[model samples]
Target: MDLKSSTVLITGGSSGIGLEIAKQLLEKGAKVIVTGRDRAKLDEAKAKHPKLEVIQSDVADSKQVETLKQAITSKYPETNIVINNAGIMRKINMHENRALEDVTREIEINLMGPVRMTQAFLPHLKTKPEAAIVNVSSGLAFVPFAISPVYSATKAGLHSFTQALRIQLKGTNVRAIELAPPGTDTPLFTGDEFTKEDTAGPKPMPVDELARAFVRGLERDVEEIRPGVSNGLKWLSRIAPDFAVNMLGKSAQNMRH
Candidate 1:
């Protein structure tokens, strides 16, 4: 879909990929609204990009998402695009003793958040002649990461849900797209456990490059946009599923402290 002159809402737009996408959309002359849970970070992002409309809302909170939906629809009824980019990833040892609620946090934020947001915005999006829903998944969705099993599972679930949503939306004005990104240079991977030595090989693609790839994919109407190593993971999973899973398992084992 043409991005220029369109209104777009991006969750988790305070930093990383979401922020990059917001910047690009603004440059493209689109009305951009960004949401983040942290008020300070949202303010910082707004300060950096004066054109950005920042909203403080936690995707994991149902009430907050409902409020966000009502606020956005009331203020920008013409909003035609929703980017489900809010998510959290944590490296956890399943064998370790941890609170049950703590262990499933990724599932709630990464998986359920998009589902909730989509349900809240689908009707509004359908009202527009042209609309899109971009769900940000991960390469780990194709192959499990043993160190972050919960995170991987959540991404996999998201991928599945996006596929189903796309099919269900057939013949509708709304379009569903999934962006599966490879390992990237973001704060999410800044922990000591994710040192350079832990990476399988070369460094990840630049965040800016990945964001550009996303826009290109969307413009081309690609259903799944797998940038960088993500494409390799998808192919490898098909050609050698067991081997790919084993490889990731080995990498996680080495990284575990």
Candidate 2:
């Protein structure tokens, strides 16, 4: 709960939301370590934030996660927080021809990565007096984004997993937190797969602002931090399920033409 006294490890910390989170957490006096699959990007992130500790690790790989767990638990024994943020979003047309492995890429990184990380680090986190596991899901978890079906499914799966994990960890020192972000101005959202027309809804939230919101939520001990449109998405999904799904599917209809 005390950000100042926390030593945090964030996956996918080289850029976008994860990087901003690392920056803010460091400013709060927390020792921040970030992991990314790309060495060059990790170096660049370190160059920008001199205080940040960078590690090259891929969450999609089970072996890398095991290595990361050993490295962090051994080196940073005081680590109390782990943020599972490494993920990718793709605009996949399920009907189109694609390799079988390629179709489940998001599942490996976005969903299973956190599951593996949690399993690997749960014991270490439990030993700490104050510990938390934060999963970065998406607003699309509540309402499927037809264009990015796999990405949406992964987030939705993560959201469910976090809920179950929270219940399983009840009465323990560890806290399970979920941060479901809305369309944020990040590389993942504005990447090659998506165009301006696909994201014609509300303007994406600024990454820095989203990070600040995340920090505040953690400080307040909020279990699920849904910023911006994420909260609305959850509400709509429950009350107007059909309309919510249709609204999200509008862009996909255009892609089919």
Candidate 3:
């Protein structure tokens, strides 16, 4: 709740939405540490924001998660917030012959990464006076994006996990918060995998705005922060699930043709 006093660790903070959040949190006077798999990107992020403490750690690897927990607990024991924002999205044509390991890559990082990170650091967080675990899911979680099936499923899974986690930690110091962001103008969204036609609907929310929403939600103690179209997606899914699916499935139709 008190951003100025809290020390936050964000996974995949090198760029995109994660980097924006790190920047905003730093501006708010929060001690921020960011992790990413790429050393060069981490260095670049550090160069841009001298205040950010960057660590090269891949969230997909269980071993790396354990090492990260040890490193953080030893060096920055005051870390009371963990933001699981590390994720990858790919446009996979499932009809093509792909390796089994390749198809499920998003699951490891987007879903299981948070699960492991929470299990590893929850005890440490619980010992603190106050703490929070912010899981960055997506609007796709509310309604499946057929174009990026694996990525969509992972976010959906994360949404479910965060809800259960919030209930389990009902009387604890740590709060489970789910940040379901809509399509954002990030490298991840505009990457090589997605073409212009694939994301031709509403303009993606700016990454900085999403980060601001995250801070505001945290300050207000909002358990679920759905910014921009994400809020609409959730309600639409409830009101007209089939229509929501058909609307999003248009991209898949384009891919098929």
Task: Return the top candidate by lDDT.
Answer: 2
Runs in model 3 deviating more than 4 A are 254-257
> What is candidate 1's TM-score against the reference?
0.96
Runs of candidate 2 with Cα error greater than 4 angstroms are none
| Separate clash counts for every candidate | 0, 0, 0
lDDT of each: 0.90, 0.96, 0.95
The digit string of per-residue lDDT tens for model 3 on 86-196 reads: 999998777678899889999999999999999999999999998999999999999998989999999999999999999999999999999999999899997787999
- The 10-residue segment of model 1 with minimum total lDDT is 190-199
Q: Assess every candidate by TM-score.
A: 0.96, 0.99, 0.98
Clashing pairs in 2: none
Better of 1 and 3 by lDDT: 3
lDDT of 2: 0.96
lDDT of 2 by residue, 1-257 (tens): 99999999999999999999999999999999999999999999999999999999999999999999999999999999999999999888877888999999999999999999999999999999999999999999899999999999999999999999999999999999999999999999987778898888989999999999999999999999999999999999999999999999998886642
lDDT, residue 190, candidate 3: 78
Candidate 2 residue-wise lDDT at 33: 98
* Residue range 97-166, candidate 1, lDDT tens digits: 8899899999889999999999999999989999999999999999998878899999999999999999
Which stretches of model 1 miss by more than 4 angstroms? 191-193, 254-257
